[model samples]
Target: MSNIKEDQANFTNGFYLETHKRWEKFSNWIHCICVVTFDLELGQALESIYPPHVTLTKQETLNICYLAFPDSNSGCMGDTNFIVRLQSCPSKAVLSNVHTAYNSKCPPALQINPAYYWGYVYFRQVKDIKLPRGYFQKSVVILSRLPFNNLFTKIISVIAPEYFDNGNLSLEAACYNIDQWPTPVPGLTLSLPLLGSVFQTFIPHQRNSTSLILQLAGLNEVATSSENQIQASVEDLNLFDIFQPVLSHIDMLWELVITAEPLIVMASSPNHCSLMVLALTRIISPLKFCADHRTYFTIHDSDFKQFTNKVHGTPPVILGVTNPFFAKTLHHWPHTVRLGEDYGQYQKYKLKKNGNSKIFDSTPGVYSSYKPFLQKDKTMIKNLISGINTKRPFEVQSALLKKHLLELTHSFMIPLERYIASLMPLLKNISPFRAAPTPLPFNPDDFFAMLETAGPQLTTGIKGDWVGLYKKFFRSPNFNGWFNNRYTELALKLQALQLQALSDADLKLWVQGKPEVEIVDMVLKIKNKIKKCEQHDIPVSHTIKEQLEQRLQDIISSLPDDLKNILQTS
Candidate 1:
C-alpha cells in the first residue's frame, strides 16, 4: 500500500511538472506585444472607476499603466491598451465569484447604474516568440457603474457593437450615466479563480487539432441534451412562451461572454454578426408538417337540384383536403345556398318533424333513396382508393415523409444550435470559425440508431423489414380494406417491437438481421407476381398445395410451446 501510494504521488508530481514546463515554454515563446495603447486620459477614466488600489498586484498595476499608456515607441494603443488594462486588473476572482453567485440558488446583488459606465479596457498578447509570426491574445474589461439596469443591454453596448449603429463611445454613454458614482462604493471584488487559467490554458491549448476536437465533442454532447430538451418542450408551449425564454437565455449567454471580455464586442465583424443572426434564426425556426389527406362529399335533392354545382354527375358538398400531418383549425359555413329548390318531398318530411316547415315538399315520387345512398358510399370508397393509388405513383409521398421526419430531428436539434449561435461572436473573434455549420441531412445509420435507442416504440418483428412497411404506408396508392388491415397489423407489431427494444433486451436480440427494403418495391414485385399468376389462371397442383401447407404447419409446430400458444391465441 505504501509503495502504491508512493507510485501514485510520483506519477502525479511528474505529470504536473511536465504540464508546468509545457506552459512555461509556451508562455516564453509568447511575444507580449502592446497592440493597442490608451492615452493618459483613458487610463485616468479607467482608474476613476476601478481605482488604482483595486489591481491584481503591484506588478499588474504597473503593467496596466505602462502597457496601457506606454510612452512613444510603444506600438500598443487603443483596443490593445484597453485589453491590457483588463488583463492587469485583479478582477478575475471578482468576475468568477459574480458568475457563481449568478448561477447560485441565491444570487448575490450586483448593482450597476448603467449611465455611469465609461468605455471598455482591452489588452492583447501575441503568441509568436519567433519574429513576425503569431496570433493575437486579447483580454477585455468593461468599466461600468455598479448595479446594471439590464445586464444584457450593457454587454451588447460594450461587446457586440455591430448589433447596433451607435458609435462605440456614444453607445457606452447611452448604456450608462457617466456622472453618477456611489458615494461609498460597494466594497466587492468578485472573481473567478480559473478565469485566467481557462483563457491561458484551455483556449490556447485548444488551438491544436486534438484539443479542439475534444472540445468540439464536448460541445456536441451539450448540444444534444439542449436540443432534446427544447424539442420535447416545444409541443407544450404557446407561441409567446416558445421564443421568450429561449431569446432570454441567448441574451444572457451573450452577455456572459461580453462581460468576460469587452473587446469581443468591438472585434466582432459585421459578417460575423449576420452569420450569427442567420444561424440563430435557423436554429429557432419552428418545424412544420404538411397534411396530405383530402375528403370530398356531396348532398343532392330529390328534385335533381344540386345544392352545389356537379362535377361530372355528382354534386359536391364538403371538400376537406390537406397535405399530411398538418391540421388546420375548423371553420364553419352555416348558410345554405339554394335551400328550397333542392329538397325532395320525403327529405322535407324529415325536416318538418323537428320544426314547422316554411317550404312545401315537391317531387314526392321521383327519389329512390336506397340505390343512390349505396352507390354514393361505394363511389366514395372507390374515389378514396383511386386518390390513394394516384398519389402512390409519385415520389412526392416518400420525399415528403422523409422531409417531415428530418424536420422533426432538426427541431430536436434547435436548442443546441441556438446555444452555439449565441457563442458565435466570441468564437469568431477568438478563433478561425464561429460555430459548426448546420449539420448535413439526416444519415440513415445514425437515424436508425436513434430510432432503436430513443424510439423503441417503433421496433417491429421484421427489424429491417419495417422499412418496407414505412414505404408502403407512406408511398402506396390504394389503401383498400385488405391493405389497411395488413398495414395496421404490421404497424402494431412494429410498435410492439419498439416497446420491447426499449425495455426487453432479450426481445431486441430476436429480431436482429432483419432486412430493410423499400415496401413499395416489395408490393410492386408482389403485384406483378400476382398478375402473372392470374394470367396463367392455372390452379396449383394438389401436391404442391399440400406440400406448402405441411411446411407451414411444421414451422408453426416448431415454435416453443408458450410462444406457439400466444401466437395461436393472438
Candidate 2:
C-alpha cells in the first residue's frame, strides 16, 4: 500500500511538472482565434448592437467575437472574446444560399448596413513575455501577466484606443434547482438534473467535423439538416433555486477586454459566468463559418435583452448572461425588429407571446447525441439518492417516492422512448439510400449500443433510474413493434437527396483532375464495403475483395506518368 501511495504521489508530481513545462513552452499570450460566421436574422440581430469599425460587402452579415479568455481552470492564461460585424464574412456563399432559401424577395446581393467592432483583451498574468512576431492588428491586444487596473488601464488607453472608455461592466449571478428552475438560493434545493440542460453549451464547434465540412459545402438546408427549430413556449421557471450555488473558483486573473460605448451590460454570478463562457466556447470554439447549432435551445445575448425589456421590466442597454441563468426568466428573444428601434433599441422588443416570436434552434448534430458506456455519468442520480434523507417510515416514504418517481418517468422517459422509437424507422430507411453501393444493414444491436453509450445521459430518477426504466420498456411485448414502426416519412426522401449531393460533389472534384480526391473517393468506397461486412457480421467474399483491388489498380494506372512512377516507387 505504501509503495502504491508513493507511486501515485510520484506520478501526480510528474504530471504537474510536465504540464507546467508545456505551458512555459507555449507563447505567453496564447490566442484562440475563432471567427464565427452566421447567416440567420437572429445571428444578425445579435450582431447589430455592436459599434461598427469595419465595413463588409452586402454578402457578409455578422461576425460575433469574444475578445478575451476567462480566468479559470481552462489551461491558458485567458480566453473568450465577443465581437460581431456586418458584412465581410468568410462564408459568403453559405450565407447567400441561406438568405435565398429563407427570404425570396432579397436580391442576389444581400444589402445590409455596414457595421463592425474593434475588440481586444490583455491577459494580466502574461506580462513577462514579449509579443511574438507578426501578431499586430487593431483588433489584437497583447496579453500580459499584470492585473487589469488603473495603471494597465492607462497603458491600454494609448495602445488599443478602441475599448478605452467602456465601463458598464458588472458581474451578476442567478440561481437554479434540480429541475433547472431558478429557485431561491440556499433553500429549496434538489439534486441536479440527470441530463445537464447546460451540457450542450459546452460542445465545441471545431471538434464537430461534420458541421465544419458541411459549412464548407455552402449548402444551407444540407448543412443545417440536423438542426430542429420550434416555437418557444414559456414555462414556470423556479427563478431562485440554484444547484451548487458556489462556483468552481478559478484562481487565475484576467481583464475584461471591453468597449467604452456602454452598448452592452453584462450580469452573471461566478457559476453563471462560467456557464456563459462554456456555452460561448462550445458554440464558437473554432468559429468556422458553420450554421449555428441549437437555434432553438441555446440562448444568446439577444434573448436576455428581450427578457429584461419585455418580461421582467428591467430594460437597459443590453444583457449578456449564460443560457442557464437567463433561460429561467425568458423563453427566447424576439426575431422581428420594431419600426423605430435602432440596434440598441431594436434589442428591446415587446415580450408578447406571438407563437412565432421566439425561435428555439437546437444545435447538436445526430452524431453528438450518444456516448460510450464507460464515460462519466453527469446525472449521478443513484449516488444522489443514496445520500438522501430517509427519516420517514420506510413503507410510507417508499410509496410516496415511488409515485413521484412514476410522475417523472411519465414526463421525460416515456416521451424519450417514443421519440427514439420514431427515429428507428428513419434509421432503417437510411440504409436503402446509403451512398455506399453495399449498404450496411441496420443493426438493432448497434442501436442498443448507442443506448448503452448514452446510458448516463438517459439515466434519471432516484429509484429505478433511466437505464432500468428503459430496459423495462425494451422488454415490453410491443416494444419491438414500436421500435420497428415508421412514424413520419418526411425525412424519407431527404436522406437520398443528402447522399446524392455528397456523391455529386465528390465526383465533381474527381473529374476536376484532383488525384487526391479520386483516391479518397475510392478509399471511402472500399472502407464502406469492409465496414458493411463487419457490421452485418458477414465475411467479405473473394470476388468482392478482388473487384475492390482491381478498382484500386485501375485508379493507379490512370494516374499521370509522373504520379504513377512516384506511387509505384512509394
Identify the candidate with maximal TM-score. Answer: 2
Report the poorest 10 consecutive residues by lDDT, candidate 1: 192-201
- Please tell me which predicted candidate would have the highest lDDT against the true structure: 2
How far off is residue 389 in model 2, in Å?
Answer: 19
- Model 2 CA lDDT for position 71: 17
lDDT of 1: 0.25
What's the lDDT for residue 27 in model 2? 16
Question: What's model 2's overall lDDT?
Answer: 0.27
Per-residue CA lDDT of model 2 for 427-532, tens digit only, reads 3343322442222334445555665444434444333244443454454322442343222222333433333333324332343465666565654564464454
Q: Model 1 over residues 456-566: C-alpha lDDT tens digits?
A: 233222122333332232332222322343334333333323222222223223233433233223223333333433343223344433443343334334455765565
